[model samples]
Target: MTPTLILAIAGGVLIAAGIYLLLERSLMRILAGVMLAGNGVNLLFLVASGPAGLAPIVGEDPELIADPLPQAMVLTAIVISLATAALLLAMSYRSFQLEGHDEVADDVEDAIVRRRAEADLSSEAYVDTSTDPNDDSDSESGGRFDGGRVR
Candidate 1:
């Protein structure tokens, strides 16, 4: 098979893996899928350079060298992948802390619902201490709650 065909087959495999990962409910898997998809696209870029181009950098005229465009694209892709992976990992950690699990109960829809619930909880000021009516406690008196509108 031609080099282009080989690249295409490899790219297709990566894309398929990415799609499969994306379908998972676990946030970690989803993020991984995104990364895989990005990599597949990067591969496609490399393959689509007409199978014969320059080395993208300052170099001697090497016969049949790949294009600079693909190399540039790959570098950008790497940076973007790193950034996206970092952000996704951060989000996964935050989700785990909030929900006590990595698998989100409602992968997509629950986000809005959970957010609204949190918003409501914050807005409701569950307590009504209202402050010390008889300012008896000294200003230096420390407590679990440092004086404020309980509700």
Candidate 2:
């Protein structure tokens, strides 16, 4: 197979594995997944940038020089990934220090919200109580309105 095809396959595999790991409840696994996905994306960017050629300099012919946009994008992606990884690591560390484990637990608030949603119950805040008989806006707008406009 061509080198580009090989790189593409490798990138795909990395991305797939990353996604799989990302689904785990462990914070460290999530961090690893993010890093893997970032590297995979970088690899994909390299593959998309076409074969390497002359350095993109002022005197170099545009056609003969490699595209710099993809390289710049990859660099930006790497920085973003690094920042995300650092944030995740910090969070994991804090969790470990506080809870003695890196595994994420289901949030109580989330569970409550899910139960409410499953029961098809709207919160008190969403229940509109317009006592004005002349106020047809709520009926027209399905109980949603913003500054006399339907939202």
Candidate 3:
């Protein structure tokens, strides 16, 4: 296989693995996923830039010189990834200090909301008491808004 194709495949695999790791609740796993994805992106950028050539300096033929845009983009992505990794590390550290573990806990409110939705029950805050049979405004249309008010 061509070198470009091989690199592309490797990049794809790395991205896929990173996405899988990102689905986990562990912060460390997420950090690794981010790093993997970032490197994969950098690899893809290199592949997209085509084969390496002379540096894009003066006196070099423009056609023979490699594009610098992709390199610049990869650098920017690396910086962003680094920032994100640092943020996640800090968050995980704080979580460990407070909870003694880095595993993320499910939110109680989200579970309650999910249960309510599954049971087809509306929250008390949004319950409409008007029982006009002629008014079909509140039919099960998934919360349509009319005239700046929820129907």
Candidate 4:
């Protein structure tokens, strides 16, 4: 019968739906889930402040009006949530661009296996990075720079 009770039920329903959508494979559904959860939390804020009443007065014994605190709090929370959502969207777009898909990356071992296959196919042995093997003269025995001094 009360607004608080109504909001409680709504919040519960929203939370349940959000959880369901979050489990879905689609990216858009995930975003929708996040948004629904945010709204559900906002409803909780309003529900905590009791039903609407007369606005507070500027007096020693102030009238018990519907608290403005929750409304202001919800506004700030909404802005923060939007900013976070935008950042998540940008990251998702970048991921899609790089991988050509929106799905989560496969297991780490799968990538490692591909890397191992490429390594096995390589024709040359490991590179000799410290010195050039082509230098066959004893005159260049000093070798590469060792601690900034020619070794």
The prediction achieving the highest TM-score against the true structure is 3
Tell me how far the alpha carbon of residue 16 in candidate 1 is from the true structure, in angstroms, after superposition: 1.4
Q: Summarize candidate 1's per-residue lDDT along 1-151 as a digit string, tens digits.
A: 9878998989989999999999998999999899988888998988886766655466766675665767788999899899999998998999999988778575564564566476665533244356675665623234343222232
Q: Give the TM-score of candidate 4.
A: 0.61
User: In terms of lDDT, which candidate is stronger, 1 or 3?
Assistant: 3
Pairs of residues clashing in candidate 3: none
lDDT of 4: 0.72
What is candidate 4's lDDT per residue for 98-117, written digit by digit as tens? 87866565677667556656
TM-score of each: 0.60, 0.73, 0.77, 0.61
Which consecutive 10 residues in model 3 have the weakest lDDT in total?
142-151
Residue 116 alpha-carbon offset, candidate 1, angstroms: 21
How displaced is residue 63 in candidate 1, in Å? 9.6
Off by over 4 Å in 4: 1-3, 106-151
TM-score of predicted structure 3:
0.77
CA-lDDT, candidates in order: 0.76, 0.85, 0.85, 0.72
Model 3 alpha-carbon miss at residue 38, Å: 1.1
